[model samples]
Structures are given as structure tokens and as C-alpha cells.
Target: MSARPAVRIVVVDDQEVVRAGFAALLDTQPDFTVVGTAADGGEAVLRCREQHPDVVLMDVRMPTMDGIEATRRIRAGADADAAPRILMLTTFDLDEHVYDALVAGAGGFLIKDVTAERLFDAVRVVAAGEALLAPSVTRRLIGEFTRLRPRPPAPELAELTPRETDVLRLVAEGLSNAEIAARLVVGEETVKTHVSRVLRRLGLRDRVQAVVVAYESGLVVPRSDVR
Candidate 1:
């Protein structure tokens, strides 16, 4: 069998040491290739446009421009299939700007203190066209933000069928495809179909956006007891 192509990646941070450190660590993985590194969001954008990486590890805060704006700009006019998946890097798990990053099109945010293995897994997950929302920190981050600033349901949300709505709720609750299948007493493929339809109908990019819309639309309420 042919070898799977390496996942191209770009590491961006204002701190020189942190940028080099992440790039070096990611390079150690056979499946990951660090195509470029940048000191700020502006430079990050340039590198991404030039390298066409599959994933970008972007710092949340930086000079010239912040990661959120860079993420928005990167996704704004780019083709959906070609846009790089952005994983925001933050110092704290509950950074106030994290919600904004998600809204700006980041697949997810990673705390800078994450272990090497976790970092590798996160990059792989995002690269595979999946959102890294299974982590408890991510759940808490979304829940807290939604609780503090709840919005009315979007009109597009009404387009979802009852089954698709249920799937979205379960997804917002951080259930995996297998878990949602078991909960609904259906086959995994059925669950996947519902999830896909839900994304298409809602015009959402991925499960992370689905979770945000679920909370914002009141289809799923933020639980104070999210663990």
C-alpha cells in the first residue's frame, strides 16, 4: 500500500521559544511535517498562503494581528476544501477570546501546557476534518461562554428535522458518533448520516460550529454541571 501523505503544519506564536518548540516536537512525528513557522498572526497568514498547510497551530494573542482575526481572514474567502484547519493556542483553558476564535472559524483551541501526545492527537484530529471538542476543557469553555452570552436561535436552525436536531444536541453534549448511535438505538452509519445532514442544513463547518449553534439557538442549554 502507498504511504499516507504527511500532514503539513504551520506553527505560529509571538514567543520565539514556544514557536520553535512546537515546530520541533511536531516534526518528531513521522505523520506530521512542519512546513513553516511564524512570529505573529500576520506572518502566520503569509506562511499559510505560501505553504498551504493542512493544519495551523495559531497563538490566540499576538502583535500585528490576533489569531481570531487571522483565522477569520484565512477562512473568509478561501475554498472550504482548501482552507487550513486552525487550532488556537492559549495560555489558559478558559481564555475569553476562545469563543471568538471558534466563531471566527477555528476548529478548536489548545492550552499551551498540553502534553506532546495530546498535541499530536489534536493536530491529527483537526487535520482529518474533525473538531477537537471532546476534551473537557473545550466543553467547559463552550458551556461557560454560551451561558454568559446566550443568543436567540438562528432562522436556519428551524430547517433541521427532529432527528437532526436531536443529533445536534447530543453532539453539543460532546457525544461521539458511536455514543450517539447507542443513545438513539440506531446504527453508527445512521447517526453519521444525521450528523452530516444537520451540518449541511445548518451551513455549519463542523461539529464545533454545531455545538456553538446548538447553544446559541437554545436547542441545547449550557449545563452548569458540565464535567
Candidate 2:
């Protein structure tokens, strides 16, 4: 069998040490390649355009431009099939701007203090087109953000079938495909199919946006107990 292509990556941060550190560590992985590094969001955008990397580890805060704007710009400029998956890096698990970053088109985020293994796993998951929504921190952040700023249910949600709607709710609750399958008494592949159809029908970019829509549209109410 042919070897799988290495996942091209760009590490972006305003801190010199942090940027270099992440790049060096990712380079240690045989399946990953650090194609470039950038000091700020502006530089990050340029590097992404130049390198056309598969994934970008983007710092949420920086001088000149923030990661949210960069993420939006990157998503806007690239075709859906070719756009790099952006993973925002933040100091706080519930960084105030994290919701904005997600809305701006980030696939997911990581706390800056993430372990090397967790970081590697997050990069691989995002590269494979999966959002990091199964993390408790992500669940809490989305739940809290939506609870604090509720919106009326989206009209687009009316398009989903009942089964697809069920999948979306479980997905918003931070359930993995296997977990959703077990809960719904279906095979994992069936759950994957439902989830994919939900994304396609809802016109969502990924699970993150689906979660946002679920909460904002009132399909999945945020629990006050989320923590």
C-alpha cells in the first residue's frame, strides 16, 4: 500500500517560543510536517496562502490581526474542499473569543497548555475533517455561549429529518459517532451517515457549527449544569 501523505501544518502564534515549540514538536510526528510558522494572524494568513497547508494551529490573540479575522479571511478565500482546517489556540478553555473564532470558521480549538499527545491528536482529528466537539471544554463553552446569547431557532433547521435532528442533538451534546450509535441503537456507520446528512442539509461547515446551530435554534437546549 502507498504511504499516506503527511499532514502539512502551519503553527501561528505571536509568542516566538510558543510558535517554535509547537512547530518543532509537530515535526517529530512521522505523519505530520511543519510547513511554516507565523508570528501573527496577518503573517499566518500569508503563510497559509503560500504553503496551502492541510491544518493551521492559529493563536486566538495576536497583534495587527486576531486569529478570528484570519480564520474568516482564510475560509472566505479558499474553496470549501481546499480550505485548511483551522484550530484556534487559546490560553483559557473558555476564551471569550472562542465562540467568535468558531463562527469565523475554525474547526476547533485547544488550550495553549495542551499536552503534546493531545495536540497531535487534535491536529490529526481536524485534518481528517472532524471537529474537536467531543471535548468537555468545547461542550461547556458552546453551551455557555449559547445560553448567554440565545437566538430564535434557525429556519434552516426545518429542513432536517427527525432522525437527522436526533443526531444533531446528540452531536451538540458532545457525543462521538460511536456514542451516538449506541444511544440510538444503530451501527456506527449509520450514525456517521446521519451526521453527514445533517451537516449537508443544514449547510454547516462542521460539527462545531452544527452544535452552535442546535443550541441557537433551540433544537438542543443548553443545560445550566454544563461545566
Instruction: Please name the candidate that would achieve the greatest TM-score relative to the true structure.
Output: 1
Q: For candidate 1, give the lDDT.
A: 0.89
Model 2 lDDT tens row, 108-201 = 8999999999999999999998788878788788778887888988887888898998999999888889899999999999998998899788
Over 1-227, each residue of candidate 1 has an lDDT whose tens digit, in order, gives: 99999999999999999999999999999999999999988998899899999999999999999999989888887766689999999999887798999988899889999999999999998998878888878878987888789887789888888888889999998888989999999999999899989988888777888998888777877667767
- How high is the lDDT of residue 223 in model 2? 70
Worst 10 residues of 2 by lDDT: 218-227
CA lDDT of every candidate: 0.89, 0.89
Model 2, 217: alpha-carbon shift in Å?
1.7
Query: How close is each model in CA RMSD to the real structure?
Result: 1.4, 1.6
TM-scores of the models, in the order given: 0.95, 0.93
Q: How far off is residue 214 in model 2, in Å?
A: 0.7
